[model samples]
Target: MKVLIIGLGSIAKKHIAAINKLDQSAEIYALRSNPHSKSDIAGVIDTYNLNDVKVSELDFVLISNPTSEHFSTLQQLVEFDIPLFIEKPLFSKINEETQSLVDEFEKKEITTYVACNLRFLDCIKELKTILKDAKINEVSVYCGSYLPNWRPGVDFRTVYSANKEMGGGVHIDLIHELDYVYWLFGNPDKTNSFFSNTSSLKISAYDYANYLWTYKTFSASIVLNYFRKESKRSIEVVTDKGTYYVDLLKNTIEFNNKCIFASQKRIADTYYNQIEFFVKNILIGREKFNTIKEANTILKLCMKD
Candidate 1:
């Protein structure tokens, strides 16, 4: 299989790792906007000049660019009819241009998938099974970590997450919280959110955001931030019977004072599983990973006020 990755950022590297692990014979190509950004992965990744590579030549394309540039990039590639595996949130925010591109995808029946690797986490999968019959009332989600700690050598302020215009913010960057909620409960009926730059971090984007979403049967509260010294990501679902907690960081779950789900596997396994599933199931039309249309719905929910 021939695969082309449009962005060579950290997430793109993970996807490349997953792809290589899945199929050793697959040829991997990457397009880097900055020549200086090139790393010494020549044998593993064949770097291509964006203008020289035709979209039709690849089996599929992975769009892992910064959030603000996603829609414009898609507009350029949507006509190719190749499968697209896009990174999450779909866009920084929805606008006419984005909606128009979505409409084009719909019209084209594009084979598209959006990345929401959190849904493939062992704890999250177990939590879904536990909540299948529980009477849910409220769901609370949170994810926080120091921005500078994300990429060891990169300056936090220089990344897209540190700039609002580039779609750098706690809420959008940690949107896995919003995505899992949508995956578990579907779209919310209404939503309101508060954003703040409460941290001492010298970034233009909000350091913290809290979102409240009301559903037909329950409500949810989600919080994300980039200032926490210790990293944490978890979800708590309250029910008439009890509360179930899924610690994504620990890959464990507890319900009614009982240890229900626990895993010792590396969290990176989720990325592998997600990519494998997308390739084996989604490509053959056996199952659907998160689709672009569904991602747009989640995108609207993320932007709700």
Candidate 2:
């Protein structure tokens, strides 16, 4: 199988490594915006421009570029109607132009999957199973880390995450929390959000976001930030019986103070599993994994407009 990955950033490298490990036979080609971008993947092909190669010839395309460039990149390849695995948040911000491109994909019946790898986590999957018959009252999810600690040796301000135009912010960059909230429970009836850039970090975008989503059956609160000294990511699902605490960073699920599931899986396993499922299910007509429609809904919630 031939896979053309757009953008050679850190996330793109993870996809390449995961795909290659999953299927040694798969040929991986990278489309990088920066000519100087480096790839750790051995023996993989690289291209600076999309015109240099035939995008239609590839089996699938993975858009791992900066959020700001996603719309333009999709516009260039939408005509090909190739299956796409787009990164989360859709774009830095949703606008008429990007929405039109998504509409075109839907109208053409193009097969596409949005990347929200958090949904594939073992702990998350196990929580879904445990909550199948259980009742929930409220849920709280949080993901926070020091901006500079994200990528070692690289200035956090220089990366796309620090620039608002590039779709860099806790709201968009940490959209996995939003996606999973929508995944576990449907859209909220009402949304209240507070976003600000009070951090000392020299970023053009907001460094903090706190949102409250009220659903008919239950309520959810999400917290995202780039100022936490110690990295932490966890979820708390409250129910009529008891609150279920899930430590995502440790891959542990506890219900009523008892550990239920403990996953020994690595973080990369989520990417591997997501790509594997997408390839097996999306390639064939079996089922649609993460449709653009659903992604758009989550995107709007992240925007909290």
Candidate 3:
């Protein structure tokens, strides 16, 4: 399966690296929209023409480009009819314009998948399975980091995370929490979200986002921040009888049952795990990853104010 990756940005490089690790048989090709786009991938020859991105030659495509143009780009791919694996926060922001296009994709029954990398993530995956049928008393996740520290080489001022037009904010940066909340528990009738760039920092986008979901059976709260000394990604699911914690950095799962216990060292790469799932669905007609429609719903929910 030949794979074509568009938008050779920071995330695209990681996706390329993971793809190389997952499957060697699949050929990798890279593309950037502008001839002047500064790409990080070494030894890669980039061409600007979209026609050069032959949808027929490639079996799959990863649309990792900045979201301001995702709608038009996606519409072009819809015409091509090849399956797409889009990254998180499907659009710049949810609105009537994007909703109508999403609805049309559903009606045509196109084969599409969205990248909620954490869904197939090893640490998160184990925790989801262990707590699938269990009771949840509380769910809280902490996702934060010093923006400048994200890429040790690049200056934070130049990154997309600090730009609003590129959909770089706590809402999109830390939206995994929102997606996983709905993944673990069903959709909530309502979600209240408040966001701000608390420090009045140099950045124009939000630095902190706090979301609260009040459900009939249980309540959930998530705090996402991009201003901090240390980088942390952790989730704690508290139940009636016990609690579970996933230390993403450590890639370990530990459950505190007092007398009983459960834990595992994660072996799968989250990126590859999700990519493998998507590839399997394409190759074998299996429902490995979340559908495009399901991902769109998650996208819409995260856009709620």
Residue 147's C-alpha lDDT in candidate 2? 93
RMSD of 3: 2.7
CA lDDT of each candidate? 0.85, 0.86, 0.75
* Tens digits of lDDT, candidate 2, 113-207: 99989899999988888888888888999999999998999988888888887778999889999988888787889999999987888678889
- Misplaced by over 4 Å in model 1 are 35-39, 45-51
Assess candidate 1 and give its TM-score to the true structure.
0.94
lDDT of 3 by residue, 8-118 (tens): 776777777777767765576777767787545654556677687666888788888887778888888777767788877688877787878888777777778877777
In terms of TM-score, the best-performing candidate is: 2
**Highest lDDT model number:** 2
Off by over 4 Å in 2: 34-40
- Better model by lDDT: candidate 2 vs candidate 3: 2
- Candidate 1 pairs with clashing backbones: 161-168
How many pairs collide in each candidate, listed in order? 1, 0, 0
Cα lDDT tens digits for candidate 1, 1-305: 88888887778888888998899888887877776666555535656575677667787899998888897789888878889999976898888888888888978888899998988988888888878888998899988889999889888899888999888788788788899898888788889999889679978998899999999899899999999999988888899998888888889988876878899965788889988888988887646567888888888877765
Ranking by lDDT: 2, 1, 3
